[model samples]
Target: MSRILAFIFRRRGHGRGWHWTDIATWIWLIGGTILMFGPALWLVASSFKGPAQLAEFPPTLLPYVQQTAMVEGYDAPLPLYTTTQEDGSTKVLAEIRRIGVNSQMVDPGNPGERINVNIADRSPVREIGLATGNYVEPLVKNNFLRFLWNSVFVTVMATLITLFTNSMAAFALSKYRFRGRDGVMLLIVATLMVPLSVILVPLYSVVNAMGLLNSLWGVILPTVATPTGVFLLRQYMLTIPDELLEAARMDHASEWQIYWRIVLPLAAPALAVLAIFSVVWRWNDFLWPLIVLSQREHYTLQVGLNTYAGELNVQWHYILAMTVVTMIPVILVFLFLQRFITTGIAGAGIK
Candidate 1:
């Protein structure tokens, strides 16, 4: 590990000694990494903490749980503490009960007699422990599997549909010359400025008219035709040479053949970028799913996780665990297709 670290930080391009700019660059990179990943690390740590540890005044990054010892006569385990005596000696004692400022403690070895110690003199014996129950209980009790299935279905189906529809729109706008072609592209781009909140009511009404409310398709259909996807694909498709389509036409190729065989394959990088965007959008979508799906069994993961929150109390542990789980798919998708992002975006605006 030391060798690997040394090699990674070795001065290859710089002179014999490290420069001030190199130091500043390393600092900036390290700071940016921590800044971006700090909250995610905190969430992972907090997900493993028990309720009592979570409620600590000065919260700890590591999950520390109070230790307990089973006394001889006691049916249940008692909390253990290290108490400081007047003689400046510390002894491990099991706390039986506490009354105001003083606690009744017994030596676990000899539990016959009780000793009174001031609460201030005793500190809890705690060790780093993970609360695995936070992750387990929700999966077992709640319909987590159903929610996962619904979310997966929505994300996959929505991404497929988004790619197909947006690519068709982009192909037409970029390749074909018609009287209202620019007008149509301008109209689609204009919709990007309209916030989702403005169309929710009418969109809801339209879905209801189609009898799609309370179904996964209702959530999937409304968001599949995104203006950003159309614009991105159209820009990328513009960079494709027109001579390719003309060559296909000269070879007795149909419009569908030109689109499927010639155009779609060439636009793969842009499609990958759109796929990533669609998956993330559909996976994390909450409002549309919440408004459409009324049944618990039909709920997506985002809406299902909301059920953990109540009017009075919120189940942070389960919520945090499930939230981490929800992020896994999106993370995997981004990591898989991330290589294409720069290529796609850079090519999209060219020509």
Candidate 2:
């Protein structure tokens, strides 16, 4: 009987422990999800609100009321007469008489009277309203379509160039058995240690000398040869079997054929991952493009977004709206290629 009681107690304790662990895991998962997506949710919500709703006194989490104000004629000082009665009652007679402007009095017998007032002009009070005009006006005024095109053009071109350059370099390092190969690999790895800022001035001079400044190629060319890309691709390429290349060689296949048919297809997952990285980096790049490109027609989406923030007043709602729009493409790209990123990284161990 005692043995039976002990076994039952142990089983109940183990079950309770598993239940507690499951509950803790769920709490952590839900909290993390909320923390990650909270800002994105807020930005989307604020995009629909106006400046007043955005800058409401003691800010509102959700916009409940729309505030509107209009300017009316200014009020002038008027005279008032106070009379005391015998019973301690006071009567105040207020006349609508302007101190600065002239007024015309009408006689009780006369119905029509004309008057002209020559007074100092009061400054006009600006009216504030909660309207969608602020958000719509900027997109129409600023050529947003052109800015978007520029962003896509730069990102796509730069990403393609980076992928091609990095993949080729990676393949060479992985498959070739030439002298100084290790030294070359070391040199490329060493570049990852050097910050790009150190070479910015020299790079700028080179680009300027080549007359690439103010051109889209200027932005695309500098970022094409990335050390990180080469490193990532090389690591993945190491996993490819040399016997495959030898087999292709026995079939009288050229190096280009081996790369295109055998290696590239095998490396698709890694290439996709690299392409995603390159596209995202180039798309969101702001400072380099701002420095290199001067023309309004050539400005990328990020540079164009900067124009919304002015010296005196900033259009926060418009800025947030544009930001939300800009992030959509990157998010979409990530969603499309996320499988590649995860699978590639995981399969890296296999190779």
lDDT of each: 0.88, 0.72
- Candidate 2 Cα misplacement greater than 4 A, ranges: 1-14, 18-29, 61-136, 342-351
lDDT of residue 285 for candidate 1? 94
Tens-digit lDDT string for candidate 1 (1-351): 999977877788655787888789899999999998899889989999888778788989898788999999999999999999999999999999999999999999999999999999999999998888888888888888789999999999999999999999999989999999879978997887776788999999999999999999999998988988888888888899999999999999999999999999999978888888788888999988999999999999999988766425877888888888888986786678766665655755421
Q: Tell me which residue pairs clash in candidate 1.
A: none
TM-score of each: 0.77, 0.70
Cα error of candidate 2 at position 92, Å: 34
Over the stretch 1-351, how does candidate 2's per-residue lDDT look in tens digits? 999955644434345544666657767888989988888888776776677577867765553433212212315422222334356564332223345564332222232432322223211122333345545766677666677899999999999888888999999999999999999989987987776578878888899999999999998898888988888888888999999999999999999999889888899878888887788889899878888888988888898888656435877877887777789887897668767666755754321
Q: Model 2: how far is 227 from its true place, Å?
A: 1.3
Model 2, position 79, has a per-residue lDDT of 28
lDDT of 2 at 181: 96
